[model samples]
Target: MDWLNYHHLLYFWVVAHEGSVSRASEVMHVTPATVSIQIRELEKALGVRLFRKAGRGLVLTEMGEAVYRYASEIFAMGRELIDMVRGRPLGQPLLFRVGIKDVMPKVVAYKLIEPTLNMPEQVRLVCREGDFSGLVADLAVHRLDVVLSDTPLDPNLKVRAFSHLLGESEVVILGERKLAQRLKENFPDSLDRAPWLLPTDNNVLRRSLDLWFADHNFHPVIRGEFEDSAMLKIAGKAGVGVFAVAAAIRSEVETMYGVELIGKIPSIKERFYAISAERKLKHPGVVAISEAARKRLQ
Candidate 1:
């Protein structure tokens, strides 16, 4: 390519960031026609189309997203450069962007991220929660520094990421004080027909618990199905029914939910992973979380 023009790149970046030429022009204090001309010049310089219209909105094409990521970083660095040269004493905090799978237990997620807050280096943490697939998609695009999930990346899926096992622990079955006292009489057998709050089928722990239940023939009547693990715990705390939680965060759950522990399911354990681009972790915050989790959970 010929010598690049930072001006054209800036215009294209704003347009991509705003998702509309008109919006970008408003922010740039220029006309929509000027923004359009700049973007066209950028596309010609880069030799790749950046965006496509999707109905009323402009959406980034695959190449557009890739270019946007690079441009975002470049402009961010440029801003930092000015601050440093001016001796502004404005230190930019390191970004620790983590993507959490929707099914991950809230307590567990807190435990994992808590270490970043204590890092000696100033860190700005950002967390995004969604399904495994969507989070992986974000990770693939450099949007996420790391991904915390219950299950490893699917081998069938073509995501170029590796899973670092954080830790694993048995699960605890908890219920309200009254239900716990009543169920404590017969214990394991008592849960056979008891009302139970369960995670949806999308959760790995749920599938593992299903197998354990089948093996022991402990079929509890499903009281509710929740897509969010935190909601399931909330419902469980409200006496909706008994529910299971990772033993790693059992104490936190009991305290937060004010629930009594009924029993432990050691046979069915819940596993946690930190998915990232590197085979071996390099991020100090991520390393701290993984190290602390292994030591604490074990």
Candidate 2:
């Protein structure tokens, strides 16, 4: 098959709009036969009839209508590209798709993304949360613009990604008011023999908390184990037991869950990261998030 020619398509486009070859030729500074032959060549290349007789004028065939739609968009985008490069605004909303690891706290995720959502320019945000490795894979293939994770990108994964350390903060033990008041004093010693709601064993926070407890020789009765941070906080509000969480959103947790802060463990820190295909951030939303987190978190 011959390669498609835009000249042929352009001639067909002009003839379609003008409704006849003679009218198109007059405007195009070509003979009617020249315009007709080019339209025939375009139809042959595409393997579809572009037009049919309707009274004295020409009307697009079904296949021609489909081609016309695509041609129209192609030309429109070309114009838009030119205008954009020339410093003209197209007013098109930017799309930002972010993937969050399932282990990440929703509140923390929201804090990280809030700045991007509040941008002056119009933007559409799409958030997906699930497996960390899978999310990293999506980012590698450009399926995701960025990814937020409680842990850094795994070094073992073959996928290429750069992890930007947003910040790290100490972990805080929280409980319902009644329980917190009882265990508030004597701090570390008070936590000994206390009823505790713990994160699932596999969790990074749980591992850190385990080490911290072992170091301090403070052992608590593990009442319940939760994989979901929000559920753990809910159980904390129900007085199930004290649970540990990152201290970055201290005020938000207090206000939203109405839980009491038992104490802050400065030694135990949880790091947050933004993973991307590029080392230097390019997406406007991602840049906003990384910059704002540097100032707001930690």
**Residue 119 lDDT in model 2?**
95
TM match of model 2 to true structure: 0.70
Q: Which ranges of candidate 2 are over 4 A from the true structure? A: 1-89
TM-score of each: 0.71, 0.70
lDDT per model vs. reference:
0.83, 0.83
lDDT of 2 by residue, 1-298 (tens): 5577988987886676556899889768899999989998888888889899999888888888778767655654544355347532467678788999887888899999999879998888999988887787667545688999888887866445789999988888888999999889989789998999887876788888889889989888999988888898898888989888778898898888889898989998888999987667767888999999987678
Task: Pick out the ten consecutive residues of candidate 1 with the lowest summed lDDT.
Answer: 80-89
Clash number by candidate, in order: 0, 0
Candidate 1 per-residue lDDT over residues 1-298, each given as its tens digit: 4698999998887777666999888867899999999989999988999999998879888999898878766765564465347632358777788999988887888898898899888888999999788787667545787899889988755445789999998888999999888887777888898999999998888898788788879888999999888889888889989999888888888999899989987888888999986666777778889888887664
- Over the full model, what C-alpha lDDT does candidate 1 score relative to the true structure? 0.83
Error of 1 at 147 (Å): 0.3
